[model samples]
Target: MKTQVAIIGAGPAGMFLAHMLRTEGIDSVVLERRDRDYVEGRVRAGVLEQIAVDVMRKLGLADRLDREGLVHGGTNLSLDGEIFHIDMEKLTGGSTVTVYGQQEVMFDLFEAAGPRGVNIVWNADNVSLHGLDSDKPSVRWTEEGAQKELQCDFVVGCDGFHGVSRQSIPDTVLRNFERVYPFGWLGILADVPPCNDELIYANHERGFALASMRSPTRSRYYIQCALDDRLEDWSDDRVWDEVCLRLGPTAAAKVVRGPSFEKSIAPLRSFVAEPMRWGRLFLAGDAAHIVPPTGAKGLNLAVSDVTYLSEALVEHYRERSAAGLDNYSARALARVWKAERFSWWFTSITHRFPNMDGFDRRIQMAELDYIRGSENAQRVLAENYVGLPLD
Candidate 1:
């Protein structure tokens, strides 16, 4: 098979890029190592930035999201037995975040692209790229125990951080920046309603806790734990108690606990790879960078990457210009670094360090107090939380 673009993943970034290219009359195909069910069922962030929401609407993919998503104007931060709200809508001149799952976004992308003949090959095996730096680049993969090949004008690696795309680049050319935190988040998804109207992030002497939701009736919650902590270590009741104690009186008063249906522990990390592009093989989303989930920038950053790549390819095919593609890496990396900074800062402030001394705790207390009291601090938090406007 031959195509203009070969996207190596069926996740939101790769799938959305294929749709965008299609609307521009560019031909592309999507390849996935996993089936659609696995891809769509994976739990991820539910927050959508305004730009991402707008893009979905532009693609005629916002009907379900608009009807089901919960729009939040603000979030609460709890510290020292006090919880304060940061009104993102008011601080950011009317911008707010929509609580729509990443899986839902994938569903919309799939539905929109299906009738239009978006060729996505699921369960492709041994997917690898060849001659990316040369014209007539090709991708090779195994399907149903048979070897297959695809020639393309470009190959995009949206397969994520553990994907083959980034590793395909030569070690000498790829520079990596990474920080693995000393702790992890033990998260649970329950059938109970969320305790608060908005998300609550709590920092107390015990640890950090978060009360979030996938919907009004389905709550997702998390508590910080040691890096070596196992899922078996936490019981449903114990998790709820820990969350309530850390969140304090105001936010915990509304608690509605139930048996947790799913539980997992995710280690926190901030990582970035310099130059998101190598030859005709471009990296997007988690394949290029990863941010700790504290600020909810992971999925949004990937969308912005698609936003940039889509425009670049459009300019290339329509105007016969390569300027956008040429500048893609620098542009994406600039935004990537800012998000990394925010996530790193937010994670540091919210999570308890094992080695934190009394002085460090005092400083954290003061910083929390100042952020709650100062409009400037609130604005900073709000702007980053709602997302910086996509460049």
Candidate 2:
């Protein structure tokens, strides 16, 4: 098969890239290792920055999101029984975030792209990319025991962190930077009402705990734990008790019980791969960089990449100019690094270190107190949380 662009991975980045390409009259095919059901059902990041929401609405994929997604103007940061509200609307000139799961966003994009004549290959396994430096780049894959090769003018690597796309680039041309945190977040989605009107990020002597929700009836919460911690070691009762302890008395009053569905531990880390492009192949989303979930920047960063990449691809194809494509690495990196800094800042302030003693705990509380007392600090948090302006 031949196409103008061959997209690896059917995640948000790849799917949104195909959707944007379709609008620009560009032909592309998306290949996914997993089936449609798996991709649509995976529960992950749930915060959409203003830029992400705007991009989806502009792409005509926000009908369901507009109807179902929850909008928030601010979030609360609680430390040592004190609360500080960072008003995003006030700081960003009316910009606010939408609380909608990444899975729902993928569902909308997948459905929108299907009827537009985009070719999506689900359950295509062991896909291999080759000849990126040659005149004809090709993708090889197997589906239902049938092996085939596809030739394309350009290839986009959006296959995520563990995918083959990142490794496809010659190791000689790549530089990697990574820092793993000492802790992980044990996230849980329960069928109870939310503990707060908006998201609450609490930092206490015990650890960090986040009070968030997926919907009016379904609450999502997380507590800091060891990176290797398992759900089997944390029963429902233990989870709730820890959540209550870390959140302190303010959140204790709002706690409720319900059927819990999803439970997983996510390690905190920051990862970036330099020059995001190799020959005719470009990397997007988790293929390029990764940030911890503390600042809710993961999904937003992925959306930003495809937004810029699709625009660059369209410009390159139409004007026969590689300027946009050539600058993709630098342009995307600016935002990526800013988000990396923000996520790290938030994580450091929220999570406890291994040797954190009473003195360290007091220092954290003082920092939190200063943040709550200072308008400039609140503005900084508000701006980063709502999102930096998309270039």
Candidate 3:
């Protein structure tokens, strides 16, 4: 197969890029190792930053998102027993975030991309990038035991951290900076209404807890747990108990627990590889960086990277200019580091460290207190939380 661009991975990053490029009459092919059902069923964070929502709308993929997604003007921060609201919209002059599932966003993309005849090869195996540093880059994959090859003007690695794209780059050229936290988020998905209207991020002596919802009728909650903790050790009852213990009486009293449909422990990490671009090959989304979910920047960051890359490609094809493409790595990384800092800051303040000493706890408290007491601090949180402009 031959195309203008070859995309690996079918997650939001790859999906968004393919669709965005398609809208510009650019032809591309997507290769995914997973099948359609698996790709669509994966449960991921739903907090869509303002820029992500705008991307969906701009791509003509926001119909279902508009009808179903929840919007939050602010978020709650619970320190000790007091919950202080950071009015994001008010502080940022009406900036807001939409709560929409990543899976739903994929649904929107597939709905449009499929009928338009966008080429996406699912269940592709052993996908490899060749001649990335050369002008004509290509991808090779196995499909139904048959080896296949795709040639493109450029290759995109949206396959994520564990994927092959990043590894394809020569070791000496790539530099990695990473911090893996000692704690992990023990998260659960339940079919019940959330206790609060807005997301609540709670910091307590027991641990950190978050009250988030997928929809009015579906709730998603998380509590900090040891990295070694296993799902077998945490029953539904136990999970709810820990959540309530951390959130305090006022918030806990409102929690209506049901049988959890999904439960998993996600280890937190902050990771970025310098220079997202490697010759004709470019990395976007989790391929280039990863942010802890504390600030809900993971998916949003991916969308933003896709947005930048799409524009760069459009500029290259439309104006026959390489300036945007040439500057893609530096540009994406600039926003990436800002998000990493926000996620790191938010995670540091909200989560309980096993090694947290008295002074550390006090500092965390002081950070939250400042956000609560000072309008300027709240404005910073609001702007970063709602997301700084994609531009």
> How many collisions per candidate?
0, 0, 0
Model 2 lDDT tens row, 77-165: 98855667888898778989999988889888878776888789999998999899886999999999999899999999999999899
- Considering only N, C-alpha and C atoms within 3 Å, which residue pairs clash in candidate 2? none
**TM-score on alpha carbons, each prediction:** 0.99, 0.98, 0.99
> Model 3, 108-222: lDDT tens per residue?
8777877987888999999999999999888999999999999999999999999999999999999999999999999999999999999999999988999999999999999
Worst 10 residues of 1 by lDDT: 108-117
For every candidate, C-alpha RMSD to the true structure in Å:
0.9, 1.1, 0.8
Task: Report the C-alpha lDDT of model 1 over 238-320, residue by residue, as the tens digit.
Answer: 99999899989887789898999889999989999988999998999999999999989999999999999999998988898
TM-score of 2: 0.98
Those runs of model 1 whose alpha carbons end farther than 4 Å from true positions after fitting are none
lDDT scores for all predictions? 0.91, 0.90, 0.91
Off by over 4 Å in 2: none
Candidates ranked, most accurate by lDDT first: 3, 1, 2
Candidate 3: which stretches are off by over 4 Å?
Answer: none
